[model samples]
Target: MDITRRRLLVLLPAAAVAWEFVRAGTPESAPNYKTSEHWWGMLIDITECIGCGSCVRACAQENDVPDGYYRTWIERYHVTDYAIERPQVESPNGGKEGFPMNEDSSGKNFFVPKLCNHCADSPCTQVCPVGATFVSPDGVVLVDKNYCLGCRYCVQACPYGCRFINPKTNTADKCSLCYHRITKGLTTACAEVCPTGARQLADLKNPKDPIHEYLRTHSVQILKPHMATGAKVFYNGMDGSVR
Candidate 1:
């Protein structure tokens, strides 16, 4: 059998993991989904984001995200006209209720949403002692909540600050790209609720997806490129001041 890299991560045999999934109540079917045929990512149009918090609210409701912690959040950036000034950033309560009025008149403000980059070379996966964190076949970095050790190694290893210890589950948690929904051919909650369509669920392997056309003709960048983590979240119309 041609097993995927993700399936091989668990110490137990493939059949055993499948059984565990069944035990954990994960759905057994995805309606003809083939992970190898899809590569998941996100395209963020920073210019179109209105900081409305619709995405944040939808993700919380959809995933049951705990308060004060965020799987996906937005940051407001105040980039001044002055060339050397650093951008002022804020995300009060993970920006779930929209942002406060910007008082700085000398600068322009924009919103940047942040989430798990789902890096192909994710350091979180490398740091997991129990193989609980792994990259899925479709390129999304995910945690095996049932198997997590609660050691917090993966959380500490993540450069993007995406992972956190789920107080409810006592395991590492972050965005899974809405795996349950996407496997059934549905968009992520954040993407679906984005009022301006600024955030889009992208399938890099699908040639017909608009992401390919956008990437070919527009300037896009991954966060902290010097780390070389192979982050999949691509940002467009981003200012250099954004971290």
Candidate 2:
């Protein structure tokens, strides 16, 4: 109430200095996020998947995907005797819950988790007339919702049926390999929640990543190699019947 000009000036500078200190003490939003430094990919170990659908549930909760649509899902493949080529695939509700018991025990049953391959030469990106869909420098395929025309060109171009039109945004949507989380140094939702360690987030650009060793020792393959999309999601112990 009795402050002079001199007191006001001195207090103002001190308050400014205190504010700067507080800002410095706060955790940085990002210390050093370099998108170009990491090339992202995923590794799904088919043998390890138990059809529990934990990954599917986690992804749905993390992404807030609409009902009946999935950024990631699990398919239960039933290969009957001598019917390896035409395995019966079923994913009710995108496998959000663990599947019912298979009554037909005559055949071998396995679960395959599916998601955006995030191809290096992505057809979805190529067919987008507005360039809304793009592969990041780190190899994650992402869609700019604001820039998308909602024409569904990218949806049609995708061979794996990964891309879908978001009901809310009316724009192309798919897995960014959890780019928001990964860029902040966290694993994808699916990978993090997997109880069997079946799902793994990989950085191909990092030679030290366990994916390299897994590839070296296991017979890994990409879905639809003939599509030549340079798919980064690698499957270990994948059956031939998977499409």
Write model 2 residue lDDT over 65-160, tens digit each, in one string: 888889999999999989888899999888888899888968778999999999999988998887888998889999999999999998899999
Tally clashes: model 2: 0
Model 2 scores a C-alpha lDDT of 0.90
TM-score of each: 0.86, 0.88
lDDT (Cα) of model 1: 0.91
Instruction: List per-candidate RMSD values in Å.
Output: 11.0, 7.0
Whole-model lDDT per candidate: 0.91, 0.90
- Candidate 1, residues 114-206, lDDT tens digits: the string is 999999999999999989999999999988999998999998999999999989999999999999888888999999999899999999999
Question: How good is model 2 by TM-score?
Answer: 0.88
Give the CA lDDT, 0 to 100, for residue 101 in model 2.
89
Number of the predicted model whose TM-score against the real structure is largest: 2
Give, for candidate 1, the lowest lDDT window spanning 10 residues.
23-32
- Candidate with best lDDT: 1
Number of colliding residue pairs in each model: 0, 0
